[model samples]
Structure formats: structure tokens, C-alpha cells
Target: MQEIKERFKELRKELKLNQSEFGKRLAVSKDVISNIEIGRVQPKTLLIDAICDTFKVNKDWLVNGSGNMFNDSKENVELEELLYKISKENSSLYPTVLKLSQLDSESLVLIDSLLDKILKK
Candidate 1:
């Protein structure tokens, strides 16, 4: 079994969250996240449950590294669900959504900046 602290750090990194952001989601201070990541403190069951519930993390993976990180089927289906919903309710928006999904990361950033400017106007 992996050490819980190391697993926690891995989970946070995989989620692309910095300590402060991760801690905010867990209702803990950044210092608490730092301590947990560095093995200075062992998380109690409450915190463990919070992590699993809040992020849809697989408890087995977080605790024992035994399974996929995200256990919830909803996580896996999010994009598909979004596309389906948009196609069903907003046919005009569905093509745009598909185009956005296919954008490269750099192009996506440029699009985001353009969208921000347009939204601010």
C-alpha cells in the first residue's frame, strides 16, 4: 500500500490543483495541505471521507492505490452528458461546443482571452 500522504499529494497533482486550491475544496488551510503532503500530519477519517466525496475520488485508490482515481461514473460521462444536453436543448450551440472541445490548448487559451474581452464589453 502507498503511504497516505504521498497518495494525497499525487491525487492533488493529478487533479491539477495547488495546495491552497485543494485545501479550499476540503475546507482546510493551505498549511494543513502542506503538512499532509509532507507527512507531518496524518489525515483523519473525516478528512479522508471529505476528499473522496468532494472530488469523487475513489477511496480505494486514495487509501490503497488499488483502483482508478475517479470512481464516479458521472466524472467519466461529463463531456458526453454536456454534449448530449446541448444537442438536445440547444442545437445551434452544439456545433460550437464540439469545435471548442477540439481546440488545442494554446488555441483554447486564445479563445478564452477573446471570450473574456467580449464578455467584459
Candidate 2:
């Protein structure tokens, strides 16, 4: 419980978001976030799911602090961080990156195959 509160604060910091901003991203109020962080309130499952989806946070780590913070492979995390940096440096790429992120695994594999063929040519 205390660990969850502490990790909640840590996750918000890792995302570079203030409580208000983090709450806005989660469609929650700042007070709600603050309460959860202070262990005055427990987050609901829906909020937890939203947190995981919006920030690519790991459910297990967020719930129990049992694993890596991000819900991604190491390589994927590196790539995501790179893309995040790029989006910050070049805002124009943000939309493209967002669209790319919405692709399913099969679509990603197809894109990867196409890119590999192009690179090999």
C-alpha cells in the first residue's frame, strides 16, 4: 500500500508530469492523484489500467513493484525513449509516432519486413 503510493509518485516523476498534468492525462482530478500518492485512497482498477495504457507503465510494477516500470521489452523501451526524445525535439513527428504506436503486432511485423527489404536493396 505504501509501496504503491511511493511508486505512483515515482511513475509520475518518470513521465515528467506534475500531479495536475498526470491527472489530466488520466482523466482524473489532481486531488485524486494526490490522495492516491499519499496513501489516503486506493486507486481503482480502471484508473490503474488507464495509467498503464497512457504511459506504457507495467501493471505488475505499478501494482506490486515487482518488475520493470515500463510495459515493454528492453529494446522496445530504448526505441520508445528514442521516439519520445524525437517527439520532444521535433513536434511534427509526434502525430506520426502516435499513429505508429497504434499499430498491432502484425502490422508492425509487416512494416518491419518492408523496412528490411528496403534497407537490403
Best candidate, TM-score: 2
Best by lDDT: 2
* Clashing residue pairs, backbone N/CA/C < 3 A, model 1: none
The ten-residue window of minimal lDDT in model 1 covers: 74-83
- What shift in Å separates residue 101 of candidate 1 from its native position after superposition? 19
Candidate 1 lDDT by residue in tens digits, 1-121: 5788999998888766799988987899999999988999998889999998877789988888887878777455355445655787889997798799899999999999999999999
Expressed as tens digits, the lDDT of each residue in 1-121 for candidate 2 is: 4489999999888767799988987899999999999999999999999988867889999999897898766567457657867987899999987887899999999999998999998
Residue 37 of model 1, lDDT score: 86
Per-model C-alpha lDDT, please? Answer: 0.84, 0.87
Can you tell me which runs of candidate 2 are displaced by over 4 Å? Answer: 73-121
Q: In candidate 1, how many Å is residue 85 off?
A: 19
